[model samples]
Target: MSERKKQHFINSVMSYITLSLATIIGITLISIFISFWVTELADKDAQAINLSGSMRMQTYYIGLVLERENVEAAQQAIEKLQNTWNSPLFAQQHALLQEPKQQHNLLTRHFGIAYTNWLHHTKPILMAMAKGQHKRSEIEFLLENQVLLTDALVTQFQNDAERKIVNLRTFQLLVLLITVSVGSLVFYLLKNRIERPLSQLTETAEKIGAGDFSQRVDVGGTDELTLLANTFNRMSESIANSYSKLEERVDERTRALKQHNIVLDFLFQTARNILESPNGQFDFQTTVENLSKVLGDHKLELCLFTERGEKPYLQLVSHNKAFAHCEQTNCSECRNQDSSMQALLLSRKTGFPITIGERHFGIIDLQLNNEQELPEWQHALVQSVANQFAIALSMSEQKDKENRFVMLSERTVIARELHDSLAQALSYLQIQVTRLQKSHDKQKYELQQPIIDELREGLSSAYRQLRELLTTFRLKMDEGGLQAALENTVAQLRERSNISIQLDYKLKNVPLAASEEIHLLQIVREAGQNAIHHSKGRNVLIELIQTSDNKVQLAVEDDGIGIPQTPEKFNHYGLAIMNERSRNLGGAIEVQPRSGGGTRISFTFMPSITRQPIA
Candidate 1:
């Protein structure tokens, strides 16, 4: 049966059971109530009968006395008793009570016959006695008949009461048996239907809580509780499937991260080499040329274009023979040129300014070789790279400025030292020489001149030391700034890997403060290396952009293998680095698997260490 239909059936069945039980119970209670009422009525009727019989006996005793006033009172009491016996009250009382059967049929018949005879024979005699006109023998015979009738009626009343008591006791025992049987049945039904299932549900819950997803609920029938158990089972299965897939993804990401680490080491070595190279001169043309060669062989054209206002100019173009030449001036030339161009144009128009610490930089563009064939992951990579480049460029420039400032501050300190020591000593020595010359005592002049010469030599030495300090300070401040570090990193990535790469020649706001820019550069280098080695992606995109909230956004996207899906693998070193860098800059990292197949990592850093103000 369908789940919902089964649920309805269960509900209907439970309802029927409940209603049936309630009806039975109601009837039982009502029957007991009726029995008690009848018993009470029987007790009252028996008392009334006994009292009436006593009154009749008393009237007969009065007749035996033959006193005038006493006989009248006795007759009045007998009349009252007869009236009560024939009343509706007595009839109603008798109807509620069960009349007992006579033990001896013959004796009962005889009693009735004798009662009738006595009533006929004694009435005339009683009238004579009341009028003082009865013969003595007739009065005696009437009295004897009255006594016989009274004895028979009294015997019948006693037997009737005794029989009713026995019947009541038998009825009470029957009711007690019915009640106990019903109660036991109800208890059994409750335990089977409710308590047992509830216990099973509790056990299942405990198992799931203890991380045993393998446990399945054993449910029968279509009851609500059974349906609840089914839902629990489905949920457990779904969770297990999801975690299994997640674990697989985690394993994949781990493998990719290991490869990325290797690439980073290679990039590191390349960067060190470039930094140690002569006169800050590196082979940029060779790097781009090699990238172009590789893409050319792959039949995938790699073109670097500069977007100026509404116009785009191609800086470097590499295409296979199948590729067509298009005008770089009009964006429409690439309107149908490639999907990457579309994405690039979209990012350019909508992209916010990129900032790193106090520095803000310009936008970036990405165009693909295949215009018609754009994969979802590829699109994601484009967006991720553009954003990463925007942020990295801004931060890279800022780092340059800070490094310069630090170097300048260091030189300034040395300058202050020179003024405090060498210059002051020179002034003191000059004053001592002037005094010695003015006094002109030959021996004093000789001694003071030697001391003055020694002081002069010390002053010359101090001046030389100051000159050296200033020179060293100037050299350190002037050479190898934050921009130099970033350039070295980019050059190394291109040289070490076969991936095609290009940095916009005129990334606006080229200079940045020291710390923020360097961190941004590091973010870019790390992400780039990861993409190149781990993602196994052919192309890399690094972007530096700014957002509306006066913050810098850095994104790095690659067509590389995507991030791990498992929670355990989700906390990998690459992710950790990305997260740490973002946190250190008071930002957050968003890592999403590319729509088609890849990973996109992006982070946003506000200019100041405070939350963005509400709009």
Candidate 2:
């Protein structure tokens, strides 16, 4: 036999509930209909009993009227009795009691005999009494019998109503028993089929949550719970497989991470060794030695070309010299060597170029042993080391170029200084000497003395200016930088003269280049000296501030006799020097009368750091 398929748990529960409800409803409706029918029958039976008693009273009335010879009254009473006997209520009751299957029952047979006796014998006797014929004995006997029969029928109807009520009560008790049985069956289905499976599922889920991936649900049935159990078992199996492999995966990741850390440390140590030297220099030999330690038995060589030559001019080798292929007297000869020999040498070695951008400086070569090849990671490490060498070489070369540029600029400054100060002083002295000679030759005694006095004054002025130029040349900025240099210049000037000189330096955050600082210091000194000698000022203020447009402004203001419109008339060579220095600094110098009765020498220029480079 084929196995019967089990219904879904929900569908089974619904069907049971629906059937129980329908049965209860059917029983309730039947009970209500029977109650109504029994009530109506009882009412009819009551009416029948009331009529029988009334007929019996009518029978007594007929007998009384017949004895008095009152034929009309007796006839009226006989007609009423006949109408009541043949009424629809009595007829229906008669038909109901005459059941074919229960004809032998005592109550049914008694009712039938009483109805037949009244219709045949008792009714005919009443009709004769209504016609005034006194058949005394027959009338009396039959009327009494009719009264007895009606009494007996009334008792039977009362008994029948009582029996119907008992049957209704019995059917209600049976329905209540059926309801209780259905309810118990429903509870059994819930506990065994639905609740038990849910409890097992909850326990399995708790175990899974506690990290026991091997736990699974085992519910069985062709229902939703069965499908859920199968899916849960598969999920647990998959999780168990993954958990078993987790340690291997973690170990693999750990090894890869350790290797990465080692590579990072190696790169860091290599960079530190290459940049360890002072003054922007690199210690390539120390870096190469470190690389040899890491490479172990492998032979490593660094071959470098000259700045303007194709031949290798320098070679640095590791401790192991097992693979020294270059044995030529001159490295240039290797370039012209036999091609087959060169190919053979190249095949035995691996090389990474040491270059940055388009500039090639050198190459690093490594020779492997027989039947050995470099791993990818080791090949990448060698390439990275070569790149580090290129970066270090590039930085060193840039520092050298910057040093040469600074030297050339300083030389230019020195030449400009000599021309502006000493050369001009010598020319003036020579012109004075020529004037003295002409006066002496003309024999002009008065002109000769004044000319000699003028010559002595010119020589004294030249010597003083020469000493100032030497002081300017020897100026060096200390750690305090431009601010400190200005402060020192102000103090020296204050000591030399009884002038109140104040320095208002506002450029605390500005970064000045070496050339910018030198030119600025020289301009300030020249301007301050001019103020002391020619302006005859009581107070001088030197202000160094930055302007709103990012230009640096230096102002030397003095409350003195101010500057003349034509400063050259007073032989102000210092003004020319200040102007020259300003031009060299790429700025403009303005010597104008101050608004407050003094001279203000303002030099405005862009700071070197803020200036854009010329393309």
Candidate 3:
């Protein structure tokens, strides 16, 4: 197709408006020129008529003067009449009337006859009368003829002026009619070509802007508006096509996002179930059931290998059924030889290994139907779930190991305490018994009493130490932690004595490990016991506080007879035990006499939480 010529709408409208203005201006200018010409001619005609009337009056004046025999006045009137008749204003009017082809015209002829009578007959006759050589009848005849001709000329001048005015009026009316016709034509053209098309284009554009892309302008013309309409239609089509494609893409993205959200929700819920399980335990059966639901039609099973890694000892199925291969006897042969288990092995299935680095725990097996397959994303999801299960299992196993280790460690500590306190006391009693036996054989009854009393004291001491050990072993940190334990110990000791004991505990915000707290509590109890037994003071103060260096400081003070400078080690087993406990806490103990009267026991140690590990 031949390309459509480009036509700007602005230029076209300007051309029409400019043409209309030019036509109106031309008509107005012509009318102005004609009106000016007609007005000027009318003024000249009026002047001519005035001059003619003066000439007629002068003719009559000359007649009167002649009748009275006044030659001077008659001569003067004749001169004035000639002057009026020959004035340039009348001459011009006369010249205008003397058209060669219009010689028979009434106004022209009348003017000529009137002028001829004035120049030839009237003037000479009047001159004759002025010289007093004239007849009354003859002068009257000439004057009468002159008056009649002048009146005829005057009448023609009036008629000519009136005719011109009528013609001007008619011409002005025609010009007005032409102007109205042209203006109406221009207005019609502008409304049809420019205004209507533009309105259509504007309305169509608004519709398109309002999202109705199907709207199109059908302006029929070769102007710029028509071209705009075509271009607008094409643009709308393009936008519609693009919008459709965009909607399709949005739908596709929405579906994919929904799938991703489902996957993420499944993973989040599974992790939450694992974390919120009772006693930090992971529910594998619940996890497998959730996994089966997420996998749609796939059958899921979790098989765990034995401790020795020889074979699978436990299996959890998502269908909530007993292990199909198990006979409840935990026999390896039964599990390995079951036909159902063999069929599952040989069938179409996918496996995700439950593993962490080199340690393989088991396999998460998905039994797929015939000809079934998994997408890459689904495969990755299943693998991630298996990894989560492996992590839970690994954490559970690690926690068990730590508990066993802690148990063994506590047992070792108990054994050591037994050997140090109770065993030693018993050995001392055995020696005392041997001494008593020797005295009896030697017939030394007096020696027997001292030995017997010594044995009894030894046994009592042994019994006391044993009870203390038992109390230490039985000590467990309750909800109130070490502070509550300390309070209970002080309360028990208070019941046994009248000594007022005050516990000044100030380490409220300090973080302490369980082992550290246990040792600290034992040391405090042992020190309190020693204070009650040996200090014999009226008041005992036990203070526990944190120092500026972030170390814990424990002080036990009394106002009683102070410890001897050379105290026997065998008598101060409590001091030895306190020293041992402080050493275990990685701290130091000080035994010093109070400045007034009693002794003070001070123990300072770095809190386990604040202590850094050795390189």
**Highest-scoring model, lDDT:** 3
Q: How big is the positional error of residue 128 in model 2, measured in Å on the Cα after superposition?
A: 6.6
Give a tens-digit lDDT track for model 1, residues 173-250. 776787677666667756776678778888978887887878887867667667777888898898878878998999
User: TM-scores, in order shown?
Assistant: 0.42, 0.72, 0.66
**Stretches of model 2 off by over 4 angstroms after superposition:** 1-189, 206-211, 242-258, 261-277, 285-305, 308-349, 367-372, 430-498, 505-522, 546-552, 568-586, 605-615
Q: Model 1: how far is 564 from its true place, Å?
A: 81
Per-model RMSD to reference:
24.2, 6.1, 7.3
TM-score of candidate 1 on Cα atoms, chains taken together = 0.42
1 versus 2: better lDDT goes to: 2
- Count steric clashes of candidate 2: 0
- Expressed as tens digits, the lDDT of each residue in 94-207 for candidate 3 is 785666746557777887788887788778877876785666678777878888888888898889889999999999999999999999989997898788988888898888
Clashing residue pair totals per candidate (backbone < 3 A): 27, 0, 0
- Encode model 2's per-residue lDDT on 1-615: one tens digit a residue: 133234555445456666767776776787678777767657676676677667678778778877787878777877877787778877764676656845545556656777778778776777776674546667777778887887787677667767767876787787678767766776776786578878988898899889898887887766666767788889888888988799689898898788768777888987886677566566666667766555555667777775656467767777746245553244433332234434554454476667899777777777765648876776788889989988888878887898899779778777776776667777877887888788778877678777678778877887888877777777889989999998988887788788899999999878998778888898999888888888887999999998888889999999999888787655456777678789988887898899988899899998878876777
As a TM-score, model 2 comes out at 0.72
- Sort the candidates on lDDT, descending order: 3, 2, 1
